[model samples]
Target chain A: MEINGKKYKAVVIGGSAGSFSVVSKILSKMSPDFPLPVIVCMHRLKHVRSGLVEGLNLKSKIKVVEPCDKDKIEGNKVYLAPSNYHLFIEFDNTFSLSTESVHNHSRPAIDYTFSSAAYTYRDKVLGIILTGANKDGANGLKDIHDKNGTTIVQDPASCDIDTMTKAALNLFEPDYILTPEKIAEYLNQLAS
Target chain B: MARFISKTVPTLSSFERGLGLGLKDVRELSAFMSDVLGIPYDHMPVSFFKRRLTNVFAKNNIRNVEHFKELLTSGDIKENIYHDFSVSITEMFRDPGFWRYLRSLLQNLSPGKTFTVWFPDASSGEEVFSFLILIAELNMLDRIKVICQHPSSRITEDIRKGILRNKNAEVNANNYIRIEGNGNFKDYYSLQDNIFVLNTYLLQNVETVTGHFLNTAINEPAGLIMFRNKMIYYDKEVSEKGIKTLTGKLSPGGLIAIGGKEKMPESTMSSFKCINEKERVFKKHGFDISWNNGN
Candidate 1:
């Protein structure tokens, strides 16, 4: 779980546009005993409250659930940012949700999760940007990079929407640009 | 009954966020803020408080933590602190499904007797208007009593005048449609110098509590308490305290609707049954009693 001499504390995945299937594949391949918690923030229809967790839980070996406010950041579980709320991972290892103004036109904006994780966990965070139509995760991924955390992005060629990963690439070089299967393999290896 | 201001809440230190306020600065500031905002502000998570405090600092040109305290003590930034510290950011019909579900629930109620719907934290007018529209559409306006409460008189007056930022009109229209709104959403509001003003007619018989009720005011038990999105800023202990207070004020089997994403505080969960998981509405555990629809 150590990367560059720092043991990773958690994995934060940010996605939008068409990332569900890739996330599902990564989750399905991840082992049940994955060492760190997986925090996922994806843009969703604000009013449509259900379905993401239900779909992800069906195939993933690990449990996937939307976390309530102040829920602890625990290992071996997936915490999906709930709809219509910006989710921040606090330094106290609890999730803080806010109804603040939308950034990048999204609640559950991936940047907030990634940037907050970088601030909280610093070099111990592993931030991954996946398929999205916007540049929501670009600055956040760079923040993780600047903080010495591991950064990964889905290969733009493999993404359903390449805009997201390309934006990250334009901002700063990532640690890895891999397909869904390779990302899964990389995550599984990191859990050890 | 217990109150959020009555209990000890965890005060946050080490506010190492984007705001450059130091640990000592926050401690000193919070000490003074607690007098004005009460304990609930102290109980707010460091992250949320930092955001609001950041707004205050930026708005008031607070040069440093000490300067910020000086402005506060001099009464220079009193209005700014009150305006920006409280979260006034909420949407009209934020969660359309919850409003729809509530509409159905109210329609089933006996309109023969007046029912009570209390907004314990109506920071904005959109939500109050949404419920008023629902009642009006159901032809239950005369039979349903509404109470909107907020600590800030300025906020209360803003809401009383139907002043709302015009940003969410499109989304609100869509949500109104989702609730099977029969009339056009535009019919309920008027454009006033770029702001959307909810027609004051919808506020008939609507009681506005402009001051903090201190959680001690006793009136007829409320059949529904609309307290959504307000508890997300609070920590576990504080939320439990507030929920316990609200539970005591609930009518027998009355319903409390919170934000869809928020969870009920653990200590107060046993006293209520979750009737809708997606909408995050709970019914107080008590014998069901019908309202008296008498004149």
Candidate 2:
């Protein structure tokens, strides 16, 4: 991503069913010198308290924290949406937690995060929709592609559960079709 | 938890069938009808008519739904019965910490400035009495004028009489004395005919009025407007409108006290500073355009 005429890179990976292992595997492949932020989203129960930040911190080299309302998205940091709140990407590169009711009964929903990123970042955005049970990330990945951003999906056969990945893949022609390991390699290459 | 199974829950199919009325109309009509019938709205999707049905069932001990429905359609109803239906079972100083926090703000007010206090949706004289007692304790009643609003005519009568001799007063008085001190309550009122007559002193001193906040013209140059736990039922936009109206009524450097759960819209908070963030006590420092030109 080129921000303020300077070149910087960032990635957004969205998933649900197999997201925990996918996120860990992707983060483990990146070198210590990875120069950009990698934000992730997985569907969460509205009322259940989020342990994603603490859970992710144990596996990833990057510092993981629950994004505060209106906290700026900084590079090399992993910001997870808090439980029971939809995380919206503001135009000014900050997060907004909405209590304005849930969409699809999931807060930190894949659709919410991806749509906002597509709106704000446009072509600078890299949206990766991964394996999950629902079709949430399907239309959202389309939104990223419609906004001229790159959209990627896990290959259905490589996915543990192909419902969500196949939904994205069949609905939208993702720019890169790969397994989780190869997707990690592709992201590492993009970071360089 | 005393087997907290709420028996007043309405037939869920009513909501499903009522869905044909359009989502917005169904929601609005349900609320209006709920108020029209004195119904215990313990059910998730409470309808005004269903609340009445539940109350009728409980009152007649008619466990059969068909019998309850027959009574509802009997078309034998009297007016003035619904007046008691609006009896909001609110406890005195329901959130004690909020009152203590409010009392602190009252104490901190500058002595020279006169403050107009308005309690929109005062709902019975409990809050008005609570405010009056707080003001008297602070010796700020002389410097303040109170304007209160409630839907109940009974509350208006109680405020005018300046006496509270309800069963609730005994429990409330204990809580009131804990903060306001024991001997302090004695100076306000005396018992007469087994009902505590609000000493004519507080009534003569504080100006209490009866009016719906929606219709009432808010011309008073208020310095402190307290609207507690009233707008929770309203939509976010409606809440903003009421807050803006109250903000317009406030004098420059005025303070607005809202319910702890309520918040000023991010765009609306620019002109005000949070005095006690957790207590939702906000002080106005200057005028903002949002509340200026009545939208």
> Which stretches in model 1 have alpha-carbon errors above 4 Å?
B1-17, B22-28, B213-220, B287-295
Q: Write the per-residue lDDT of candidate 2 for residues B1-295, one digit (tens) a residue.
A: 0111112322122211222333354455445433544331221122223333344444556556444344444633312223332334233554566677777666555555566788776656666777777777777767778886655566667667765645456556666755654255556667788776766656556665555565574577787787765544343455676777777788777778776445676667876888776567787876421222111
Measured with C-alpha atoms, the lDDT of residue B92 in candidate 1 is 79
Candidate 2 chain B, run of 10 with poorest lDDT: B1-10
Quality of model 2 by C-alpha lDDT = 0.62
> Model 1 chain B — which ten-residue stretch has the worst lDDT?
B1-10
Model 2, runs deviating above 4 Å: A1-192, B1-89, B163-166, B180-187, B191-196, B287-295
* Interface DockQ of candidate 1: 0.29
Q: Pick the candidate with the highest DockQ.
A: 1
**Which tens-of-lDDT digit does each residue in A53-90 have in candidate 1?**
99999999999999988888999999999988999988
TM-score to true structure, per model: 0.90, 0.46
Candidate 1 lDDT tens digits, B85-162: 777655777788888888778767764866678887777788888888888888888887888887767777877787
TM-score top scorer:
1
Please give the RMSD of candidate 2 to the true structure. Answer: 14.9
